[model samples]
Target: MKGAMKALRLHKTTQKIVDGLKLETVPIPEIGPRDVLIDIKATGLCGSDIHFIDGSSILPKFPTILGHETAGIICEVGSEVKDYKVGDRVCANFATPCGKCYQCLTGRPSICPNRSMIGVTDDGAYAEYVKTASSALIRLPDNIPFDQGAAATDAVATPFHMISKRSGMKPGDTVAVFGLGGLGIHAVEIARMYGAGMIIGVDVDDYICERAKKLFGADEVINSRKIDAVAEIKRITGDGVDISLEVVGVPESQLQAVNCLRPGGRALMGGLGAAPVAMPNTGIFVRREWEVLGCYAFENLEIEKVLKLASAGRLDLSKTVTSHIKLEDISVGLQDLHQKKGYPIRIVAVQD
Candidate 1:
């Protein structure tokens, strides 16, 4: 805990991710009385990380390590931490919420105004070591590998939160997932796991669309570039889908998500976009009783539930991890994600 460790630090925002991030030796994060120090074993690259690099997402401070989806071993424990000890395998809930805040007290801690997010608001796990509160830690079962455990933290958990908690997707409901990226692709799998009657995946990339159908649980896939996705979805489902999740974070995809919903159906927006999305026609929306809800990241307990599901073999993340790279090659992974080079579902940075 005393010596320096190598981390990929973001000095500034740049379109070129490699230019913005510098891999340098920095002091290991010091722990507080209620904190724990982790030796990062596996971490994942996400679309939000790309958004930070492209200036679409804003960071509170610069020179911060940039990774939130992580799993590791506890190397040190704080004096006041009672539940956890060193050498425990764990994955973290990146959002650290203030327990006394109004949102936290009301059981909506995911949106706590006082919440601090790892990688976004503070130094994260794009390094050899990272530190977070003991409350943010969730025990990882021995059956799960570190890379799968890391992906479960965000790539899988976020969509599970959106579909299971926010979307109101009942068994046998028709579901449509927009964007076949990391989060969206997982949405397809979660929808199927929840017993969706039909799961449709929408994306511009043909490769991702095909993979979602074959590997993930998508029953149908639509490439928005070649055809009218909304019309096709309506034709397939007979009156649009029961639940539509927009994880693309773009105005067009968000609008399409709303449009491809049945009357009184829900549209859960999980993607974060800098631009304002145009509101739907008020007359039609009000008449149809359509609901558009915003879903933030998963709750801390949800991460535990996801881990249990994975451990029980109810959820499969085998294909979710597209590839693995070394910590030094994080920039390359980010570039590959940004360029959609490999149609990656989740590219993880694992210990070499």
Candidate 2:
């Protein structure tokens, strides 16, 4: 744990992943009193990593590692870390919330202003070893593999939070998920798990739409590019869906998600986009009495719930991972993800 480790470091923001990230031999991270060192076993690539490379998201410092969805084994523990010992299988929540903040006191710690994110604000797990506070660790069940454990940190937990907590999804409610990417596909499955009467998956690509219906739990799929998705959804459901989730950050999809809802319906916004989105007309919005809610990352307890679902065999993630690549091939994987190659749901980096 003391020697040099190979890591993908970002020294500056660039338009391309290859140009921004360099695989270098750097010293392993040192642990503090409340910290522990994890030997990273698997890490999942996310769209936020692309945002970092394209300069859409800026890092506070230069030369930091870039992966946040991670799972690993405890290699070393600090002197003050008594609950966890070496060789414990665990996955970490990227956001470390300060327990005393106003957000934490009110039971909403995911948005803690003083929270520190693992990949965005600090060095993360795109390497062999990562240092994290013990408080951020979640126990990974033995039944779950490292790859799925890594994905559970973000890809699964994010949508689960939006649906279970923010969307106010009741059993038998009709649901529509816009954008069948990693998070969107899981949204379909989670909606079904929550006893949704009908689940529709919307996307611009035909391949993902097909996969959403065939493999995932989507009852119907719509190619938004070919036809009017809102009209088709209205046709499928006589009145419109009771709940709609906009997982695509584009303005068009956001508008469609809102318009596809029934009166007094809820629209949960889970996607992250930089462009400004125009709200619907005031008269229509007021008449419909629609509720629009913004959902951020998951709470720490939500990650545990996702893991429990995965462990119980209720949530099938066997087909979630599209491909597995070595740590050195992460740049190629990122490029394929950015290009939508093979319509990958999730690309993971695995260490031998």
Candidate 3:
């Protein structure tokens, strides 16, 4: 508990597949006055971490610890911290927004340009211990498991923000969610939670599509590789869907998401692909009155709400997790995610 801890780290960004990360013994970070030291219990793998490892610009810098979805028990608190104490189970907001920023002042702290995100701009929870600002931590309720608590940071909180704040999903709206990854799977659950009349989940893998329908409350499942997603969606819901969420941020997926929307529908984009998107003619957008919105991370309030919901059994996301691994098997987990070896919604790395 006092010395070095095992961690998976990206020494540098690389194009070579799975070569960017290495298991290293690093010192447990020391907490500052406004920070707390967390003995991480669980951390979920994210697609963005793959981008960071593969030399993508998803992260601001390299040679840093890379995990955002995390939950743990507090082992130590800084001198300035008082509301929390040792042995407290908690998950935290991934970034600490500068309260003085214009976006923060405007009540959009998730988009604050000056925010410092865990695993992107600072050392993250992939290691045995992580030091984070006290203000970012949220206590996990007694009933929620640590992995589920970890998932609240991104998997649940993100889609909650998108559906509740960005997409304007209503009680009976039809929704098409493209990409059944961690984020997209949650999109389905959240859509159902909001009383979606028809929830369609789109993914290339047939297994994922099946899981989305059987486990995640998706009313319909579309295999993008087998059929034209946009056409199928239009056929399923006459005049297109009421809302479309593009969880995969590639140009093609973005276009498909836009194309699958009704004339006056909204498209909420959450993916972070690097390629530039080609939009339809300006006149088409003008004529249709379709709205396109971009969603970033999540708000602390939303994360707290999701945690509370999960704790109360109102939101059941335990089925979304596919595998639980140890810190040493990170490469295998990353490989499974990268190669599409299995239709894994989430692969969590638990502390050894």
Candidate 4:
């Protein structure tokens, strides 16, 4: 707990991912007065981590650790950290928001203008040890496994926000999820949890669509490559979906998600990419009264609800973890995810 620990790091000196990522031993991070040192039990590989490797604007610093969706056991706590103690099981708020900021004070920490994210702006959980403010730590229940805890941090939390906050999903509402990637798949499951009457999962990949139905309990699956997604969605639902979530950051998919929403229905956009989406027709917003809202991550209180659900056995975060590997294989996992080699929802790295 005092000396160096094994870590997967991306260095500025080696910009290319293949040449840059390395398994190295680094000093275990120390905690400040209000911080807690966590002995990482499991960490998830997310798409945003790739941005760090690709030198995106998200990565605020060079030579930073990358895995952000994580869960661990508290190994050490600072003098001011009274709520948590050593041996406590927990997952952290990946975004470090200034508690005094307007967004934070207004109960919207996810969109805090002055926030620093783990992995992107700070040393993250790719290492055996991580240090975070005690305020960011969310207590984990005894029944939940570390891998599921890690996945729930982002994969589950992101969709929770998309459905609950952005779309105001309600019971009996029909929902459509575009893209069957990790986040999108969870959107399908969480929409179901929201008591959606019908859940549709759309993806170009046949494998993903099948997994969405069999694994995530999607009521219907659409292979967009073979059929007109918007048309199919309209045919399935009498008018259109009550709420549609676009999880694939492509302009076409964004358009499809909005087009499939019924009049007065809302759409949640959680995906991100370089391509810009053209504004929808004026009538769609003006006459139809359709709503499109962008969602970031989950709130701290929202994550607590998810963790509690997982603890009560009401939520199954385990299904989202498709693979479990060691830290040394982080690069291989990242490559597999990048190339879409395996139809993985979430790949987690576990400590041996």
Candidate 5:
């Protein structure tokens, strides 16, 4: 539990790779051209890892390492790497982006035609070391905790992408978010930071509902199982939310997301449910003409914005981290995660 370290890995034919975690004596990663080798300080467990574990995620080749949200210290850099050096604290954005792709050229690298995420197509964190493109690594401030930096990509960056870049949110917009888990909490905080007038947080669990208002700054919290989320949201916002986000992938939540939107509003789906998305036919297009979309991962601008928020201390993300475990307990942690049992604000796999 001390030195070189262990990791949780998956190597199935398809990406629906389960956790085939094992202990091995591996050397520190070597930097490739345009790469930097990092001594991983912290890494966050993500919902996408859940999809991949069940063999339901999009992946390139198999035999990949898990744990994507990474924060670490630069240990080595390739000869060609620039703007960074050894001893820098860093976090990564594009796990792997094909810079020549059309999507990359358009400054929408999140949708890059040939991008591959860590722990999906390639080896990721959950190890003592990780290597990333120098361009993908952003220097982290000393004020950000190692665990928060590890989660910067998921808890901070991705939601910033949805609110600041993708949502086109202006000041005083009303936003409703479905799910009070990690990403849902992030959505709530990010919406508040964007000057949203009212933030409606939703979940089936009453604990989450209570937690939303107390910790995440949600102006209103709803337990969808007992109350009609759509009607309640409309009642609170008085016009339905300008933007409604589904951070939980349950079929019921998805259905409620469509109804939660005001006419001509937008519905953004950021959760991963491992099932096909189904929406009403005439009810959506004919009645409201609402816009429905999905966002995966994030881009550089959002990453920078989130880092600034963390550095300046503008966001209330205190309730998000409820647990931590060393590499030895990763299997137990993964099991708890699979069941959604005792949802943690941030579950970090770290070196002991």
Candidate 6:
């Protein structure tokens, strides 16, 4: 605790993600009297982290330690820290809410007016140790491994946030999931569990599409690249899918999902992409009363759902967790992640 711990800091001079970064003699961060010091167990690589490397996050500035989907063990606690103590395995939620805000007062803390996210609005994990508010720490079940907890934050949680919260998919509903990557594949699984009559998986990779059904138990899979994905989906569902979850943030996929909707279909568009494209206004007005939704990060974040899903064996935890690397190998991990050779769901960076 007295000596400095290793950390990867985004270099300010060249705006680059330099690995083997060090904080040779950094201080143990001061507790806010309500914060707890966490001995970071593992951190997951997110597409957003690549944005930080490419200098494209909407976040204000750089020189930040970049990681959000992280889990750790509590090493120290401030006087005001309650319900948590040293040695508790926990994960951090990105949306830190101010209790006094109008949103928080109305039981909507996720959309709190004064929200500051780690890794973007503040310094974050990607270090040996980090500090977070006691309110942010959700204890990990003893049965869960840190490596599994690492990817639980978003890769697993985002689908729950979208399918249930944004899309409002219910039992007996028919759902369409576009772009069967980390979030999309998970969404398909959730759709199946939610008792959707038909779960359609759409992706450019036939391998990923096939894996969606084989591994996650999705009812049907479609390759958007080979066939007219929208037309095929319409043909399968008679009119269209009841709910379409768009995980690829590419504008074309967004349009394609919307175009493939039945009357009153809900389109849940979620992912990390900035490419622009146009959508037809009348598509919703004429036949389908479609809800063109925009989903970013998870809202009203709950760590338990992701863990519980894994714990209950509902999620394909092992299949989704693709790569594991030590802290020193982070840079190489990021590069390989960008290439995405085999459609690994979560690339976790852990300690030796």
Residue lDDT tens for model 3, 1-352: 3689877788777776467778789888877898988989999888788888886666666568888889999999989998999999999898999999899999999999999888889988778888889989999998888888887789778889999889878899999998888899999998999999999999888988998899889999999888999999989898899998988888888898988889999999898888886467789888999999999888889999898888788899688678898877776787788777767778889873
RMSD of each: 0.9, 0.9, 1.4, 1.7, 2.8, 2.4
lDDT of 1 by residue, 1-352 (tens): 6999999999888888767779999999999999999999999998899888878888899878999999999999999999999999999999999989899999999999999888988899899998999999999999999999999999899999998789877899999999989998888988888999999999998998999998887999999999899999999989998999999789998989999988988999988899897558899899989999999998878889888998999988788898999999999989988888877888999984
What does candidate 2's lDDT look like per residue over 110-158, in tens digits?
Answer: 8899999888888998899999999999999999999999999999999
Candidate 6 lDDT over 113-213, as tens digits, reads: 68877777777777788877788777787888887887777887788878767888778888888888778877877778778889889898878888898
After superposition, candidate 6 runs with Cα above 4 Å error: 12-25, 283-287, 299-301
Better of 1 and 3 by TM-score: 1
Candidate 4 residue runs with Cα over 4 Å from true position: 13-17
lDDT accuracy of residue 295 in candidate 3: 94
User: Residue 340 CA error for candidate 2 (Å)?
Assistant: 1.1
Q: What tens digits encode model 5's per-residue C-alpha lDDT throughout 124-226?
A: 8877787788888877888987778778777767777777777888898888999888788889888887899889899988987898898778999999889
* Better model by lDDT: candidate 2 vs candidate 3: 2
> In candidate 3, what residue range of length 10 has the lowest lDDT sum?
54-63
Q: Candidate 5, TM-score vs. the true structure?
A: 0.92
Poorest lDDT segment (10 consecutive residues) of candidate 2: 12-21
- Among these predicted structures, which one has the highest lDDT? 2
Give me the displacement of residue 244 in model 2, in angstroms. Answer: 0.7
Candidate 2: list runs displaced more than 4 Å: none
C-alpha lDDT of candidate 4 relative to the true structure: 0.85
Q: What TM-score does each of the candidates earn? A: 0.98, 0.98, 0.96, 0.95, 0.92, 0.92
Better of 4 and 6 by lDDT: 4
- Model 5 gets an lDDT of 0.77
